[model samples]
Target chain A: MKQPHIQLKLFAALTPLSPENSDRVPIEPGISIKELLDHLDIPIVKAHLIFINGVKRSLETRLNGGERVGIFPPVAGG
Target chain B: MKNTLSHRLNTLALKASLTDGTPCRTISAAEVIHLADDTGITGRMVEIAALREQILPDRYLRNMKTLSEADQIRLLESAVCIVGLGGLGGLVTETLARMGIGRFYLVDGDMFEAHNLNRQLLSSIDRIGMPKVEAAVMRVKTINPGLEVNATGAFLTSENADTLVGSCNIVVDCLDNIQSRFILEAAAKRAGIPMVSAAVAGISGHVTTIFPEDKGLENIYGPEDQLNMAKGAETRLGCLAPGVNLVASLECMEVVNLLLNPQKALRNRLLVIDLEDHTFETLQLA
Candidate 1:
């Protein structure tokens, strides 16, 4: 049996995640957003918004294997 | 210079106190002598007793006025130039305006959009489509009519950067784009004025005091190319009032503290705040 791989994409300001700054975390098959965050040690409450693939998702949303997740901090502008 | 404390106190008596009960007083040299008498520091017939020492005491005395009329005037006369007039700029402008800053040069090419109401103080349904700088002047005047505000409804670009910063003592970079930030920072450095810059990425925000002589935006944030390469949106991505105010409050604190003590100010440190976890920390940019 082959193992599934997961990719977590990080972005800030206008800068997207580069190979140097990106983190590749693998997970066992399918994991929920809450579980994925817990695995990354990220506080779910601290996240302003979360994006799984390209669409916004809530904390309870599950993540499919090889899904790219982007988590945004709160919006602190003007 | 004559002490104007007494005169200002008299004027303040007529002016209603702020919600905080602190009378907004803008003093001048001529009123210092009167202040000295009212505060029991001067006599009607006594000679001016070391006026300089009387005004600027090394230590603040309890229950006694620490600043003389002249000192008060000088402090209030300080001018701050804020560029962008967006979320961070709007908050910074409001804070400084309420702090009794004597003058401000408000610059912004953008107008109030319906989307801005989420975080911008000057944004409203009626104000939507109005220039940001114009609305800012009206709002600030309502708070402190004595404030000398110059609303320039023009975008801040590298071309006008020199002229914009030449006369202001301090420049605040509240712009979202890196190109503008770099231009404004360069202009401020050339003008020999200090700049307090703040930026936010999602819930993470950074505040730093930039002294042109020492550390600068370039060396700290890296080159323009590196900054531009990063992906961020200028439009608010669900901008919340709490988050904007949080960063604004921090920026305001640094600005006010710097105005009070320019010589001993926050320099070369990036203060980052994460409201999600209520975490506030400082990172040194060396």
Candidate 2:
């Protein structure tokens, strides 16, 4: 049996916090976006916009593995 | 805007054959300037008169087909207020001016600094201490002497936001900070105009359009206590030229789209670009 996993991508200020600096991050099945952030020690406030496989996702959305998650921070500069 | 002047300009309009063998009425930029000098009218008026007769200006020849002659006239009749004159604001003004935006209200109290040379299109070593707004206004004039612009070398504050964005067809929020952005958005809301907003941070940038009735910057940056007065991710990650210029170009496109076709405007949508991955994605903001 294969281990449950999800690809994680981080952007902006959160880029430094990405695990191994790679998108192939393992995750627990049925994990909510909020929980994934918590597991990675990424504060919820810093995750301004959360996306799952190119589509916008709510913090409460659940991931069942094999999903690509991208999180972005608030970017405001000229 | 006077009909008598327009009528006189209409008579100056002459039919010409294009390289494609299509015959159409056209007016040269020189002819428009000459008419302005002779009649003591604005070159904008003369250009408008030429467009009224379907006489396209030689200067706007490149915008043909992509923008119908009617759209060119619409652009000439439009005005936009661009707040801030740093990386994003500088390039946004440059693009819009070239696109034939007739009037502009430029606001920025900041002057060009050494760091601006990397991304600010109008910045130069010689203009290190010159106000960004002044530099932008001069550049716009050189691009199209007929364009009218009101440059304010003052930062947009609560007391002056209303006046800074007064009576414009649209507003472009190229501001650098979260607080100023919210202030500009509120002013645009009170004035009942749409605003094209964009920001940059390191290798990433995002563009969004906020109309008077939209939720505005608060949605992107979150609640007042949570993020209002805070600096954005840019301070931590830093800003660069590529993201800045790309975002400004996107904002210009939004401005033009709003002007030519309101239905196609980027209302309730956030388009994000990641330079590292070279990906552009539109996320729902509604």
Candidate 3:
């Protein structure tokens, strides 16, 4: 049987760190967003904006298998 | 009498090219000025009177089919406040002025420095020490002398936000830091106006429009803690021209939409653009 997974999208500086730079990522069930970031080697500081399945969510929000996630670094300038 | 003004406008109207070789009945900018002086009405009223008669101001003839004459007149009566006169605010002010926005409240405390020349639209070598708002007024007046401008060199803070945003149809947030963005969003909310915001760092940028009733920058930049981040990615990654102009253009487009076709404004969402990867995405926001 295949392991359950979530689609992951990383942006800007975070893009290079996506697993194999691929959008598809297999995940263990019931992982918190912060835990997932840790699993992916993203520091908590760089993960400024987090959206889970099109909704703004907190780093503490847990993700079950089969969610789509996006992470953006704080890109602030004029 | 309004009829007399209309009659005078009719006398001023002449057959002019509608920019594609099509003949159009239009009043030249010069003619509008002369008529405003002759009739003792503001140039804005003269333009409105001309538009009501289906006579195009030659300066706006090119906007014909895309925007109706009434739309042009609406543009002529609008007020916009641009909070930062750096890369994004400079382009937005210049572009909107050319588009015929009638009034402006330009606020920026900084002066042009050598570093601004790379991307700031209003900065030049000779004007290095001039206040950004002063330079902005000079450029705006030269573009459309009919415009009314209230320029301030004080920075945007809660004390000044209400004054800057009052009576304005909408606000554009070209501010560079997270702290100021929060302050601007709050002021726009209190004034019950919409704000179109954009920011750039490295080759990437983000654009979003916030309606007064909706949640603002906190969702995108995170809660109060992120504000303490001091400088953001821009400090380390730096901003370049392509990222600045592209994001600023998106903000300006949102400005136009909110003013005229407001139903189509980019509300409740964020547009992320990565020039290096050439990818653009719109994600729903709270």
Candidate 4:
């Protein structure tokens, strides 16, 4: 049996956290938002907002494959 | 009273040789000043001048389609305080001035560095060392001389925020740091004024309207200690012009909506936009 993967879309300050500056990345399904952030080298502390399938979610929420995840950094710039 | 105001306006219009119901044209600032001095009533002069000169004198003529003349007048009489004259603040002030806001109190303690020219609307090479608030005041004066702008070249803090934001009807948060933003939010809350906050970095931005009773910046950034340990997006990814402009525009719209149609404002909702992928989503805040 093979594990499923979910797609991630990193936005704003979170883009730099991704390797190669790719806008989209694949991650293992069932991984919590916190775990996915860790895998992508994005400090969970740096992310201020997270959305899954266009809905706001907590870091502890688990991701299912085929769902789109968006991560945003706190854009404090004027 | 309406008839008297209209009669005074008509007399002024006749004196200026401005025909009624014509295309918008400019009225010399000198003429308006003289009328203000003669009548001893500046408001009536402004009203008459705005109507006779059409769009040019009114400056907000286009706003008539969306806002009633009374609403437009309300805008002209409203006072808004902009905290931070960097990227977002510069654009917000520019748009608000053009919209005929009556008064402004601009707060910023920083001087324009070479790097600021990349996004700050009031920043130019010649103004590299000028105070941001000074530059903003100069720009506002150029945009709408009728507007009264007070430039405070001091950083907003817990001590001074109350004095700076207390008198204004609305507060715009264009700050670049969480600490300053929190300070501003607290002051705004204490003053019982609504705050329109916008922030951007890279190709994404976020906007929200927070009323006095709302949790505001706290809901988005969490507690101060947690935010203090985290770096802002600008520090990590830098900022771009498009992101700054888009967010500022939205923030300005929110301010206008808050003034003219409070029921339709973004209030309690966080609008997040990712220009990179063209994704815009509004999340309901608790």
Candidate 5:
């Protein structure tokens, strides 16, 4: 079977992790949010908020194919 | 007794009329102070000032259309604590003061630096050495003299957070560090006050409202230990003025909505904005 794919969105400082600061990327399926972060080389400590299909999820949460994922860095500045 | 209040209001109203005679009648800040001093009842003076446009010049004259007279009175009676006086806190305090919020507790331990001129509304080259809280106080006085402000030039710790925010109806999280934000959230929770929090980095930022019953900042930033281990984007990407102002404006709007119409305030969700692509997303918190 062909590998399933998911859409990923990186925000703010996390964009630099990707080429040309592309906001979206396609990822393989059956990956936990933590694994995806690692695959993208985004440190787990740098990923402050993670959401799948508009619902916040923990790092251990598994993502199915075709789901939309959004990741934000901790932006604590006043 | 009602007649006495009306009579005093009318007297002050007459004293406040603009001499320019362009028909945009407005009172000077000096007149309001004089009236409040003479009446020995600042609350009554504030009420009269809010009611009569000519008595205490308000930029929010149109806001009264959406906010009923009673709501305006409520704003005049409300007090909010701003825990920082940097980019976000400076703008938030200015907006609230213009919206006629009656009292403010401005807290910050930092002083204005030359670099702060990039985004801090209250910071300037002339005031580089001045304490941020003092600058905020001066700015609020210039914006609306009727506002009662308590400026604290000390950093907020667990020990002093409660005392600084205990009397406020709401707390705005403007601190730049996760540890300090946790301190503020705990303090607000202990005081049973709702907190409107926001943060900015690059061209993006996020805002959320946390009531006492909610999970609070911990849900977004994770456990205290985890937060201590992590780094904030501001430390890496730095901050942009437009992003800070945008997020702070949204935070102020949430605060006003919370105070006047709690049902409409942003709660239980985080609203994130990316000016780079102009995409705004509201994500539900687990």
Candidate 6:
């Protein structure tokens, strides 16, 4: 039997279960960000931007091991 | 009575020291009492003396007689122009006000919203709807009544930046946006004033003192391209209060040291602080 791939970890400053957070909702490997968000019940519309390893990445990008993914809402204040 | 005493002290001690060759240092109790007018600055002078003594050692205090009480008064009258009244600028204004910088040209158009309540010192429940500049002015006045604060509630565009930057001893860039920061830098350079800039993102922040002819900040942050990227990609990770306070305190120290001793200023270097990992480091850009 093959082991389950646990490659994606989501984190953010004011988000649910961020990388620096332990309550994170992890996802299996070989999944796109859109798929993972769908599986985790996270609203992509609420999270306006995404980044991997501190560089902005597209939603269609696939996850890699040990990558730090961050999600954030649009900033309205100064 | 307080103002009377302060005025009397100002007249006697300042007149004697200005006319004669007194040490021009800290005023003595006799001078304070003799100068005491009906206004009665009885408590304020004592408080100022205590603050000065605490911050300045006896050795440095012994040689102060050179400047008259009037001149000491003038030092307090110096003006500073600060941009961005946010994390760094808020605390910088507070520190300078406590130090008796009598005047400030505060420029910022943002309102005090819920998000800023965490790190910005002036953000309060009562002040949530007020403009940042207005809130900061109130806080500074509460700290020191003598400070003359003027607000420019406008974004620092190239239109009025030169006029604003030209009027102060130095410019402090605590701005978050890139284009505005670059415009402020350009204005400072064009006006030939030193700019002490600081940036805080999440648990990381950096402070750098930039002189007009120096290429220090452009080196680490890169030219306009990287700065724009950093601005655009910047997630509102939201800095904690402690992080902003630490970086703001450092910026204030840099400004004060530069004002007093220009020869030993921290020029062309970025002092980075990472509170999450407990790391304090410096990167030289020259």
Please report the candidate that would top lDDT against the real structure. 3
**lDDT score of residue B80 within candidate 4:** 96
Cα lDDT of model 6 by residue, B25-70, tens digit = 3444344333333334432343244334322212224325553334
**Sequence-dependent TM-score of model 2:** 0.92
Indicate the TM-score of model 6.
0.63
Poorest 10 consecutive residues by lDDT, candidate 3 chain B: B222-231
Candidate 3 DockQ, CA atoms = 0.64
True-vs-predicted CA distance for residue B85, candidate 2, Å? 1.3
Reference-based lDDT, residue A3, model 4: 57
Global lDDT of model 2: 0.85
TM-score of chain B of 3: 0.95
Error of 2 at A12 (Å): 2.0
Candidate 4: tens digits of C-alpha lDDT, residues A1-78: 565555577778676565563434555767898998787778887677777776778899997667777777777877
Report the C-alpha lDDT of model 2 over B1-286, residue by residue, as the tens digit.
Answer: 5547667667777777655677877778888888888888777777877887778888887777788878988998999999998898888899998888888899999998898898899999999999999999999988888888999999999999998887798999988888888888988999999999998899798898999988877667876566644577899878988888898999999999999988888788888898987968887776
TM-score attained by model 3:
0.92
Q: List the residue pairs that clash in candidate 5.
A: none
Candidate 4 residue-wise lDDT, B1-286, digit = tens: 6455445454444222224443444444555555566666553337544654342343444554566556776787788999999989999999998877778999999999999888889999999899999989999878755567888999998889999998899999998887888889889998999999988877688999999999888778887766664347777667888989999999999989999899888887889988887978887766
Clashes of each: 21, 0, 0, 0, 0, 20
lDDT comparison, 4 vs 6, better candidate: 4
The 10 consecutive residues of candidate 4 chain B with the worst lDDT sum are B14-23
lDDT score for residue A10 of model 6: 33
Worst 10 residues of 6 chain B by lDDT: B54-63
TM-score of each: 0.63, 0.92, 0.92, 0.85, 0.88, 0.63
Q: Model 6: residues >4 Å from true position, as ranges?
A: A1-78, B1-7, B10-77, B225-227, B230-236
* TM-score on 0 to 1 scale for chain A of candidate 3: 0.88
Report the Cα lDDT for residue B147, model 3.
74
Candidate 1 residue-wise lDDT at A32: 82
Instruction: State the C-alpha lDDT per candidate.
Output: 0.63, 0.85, 0.86, 0.78, 0.81, 0.63
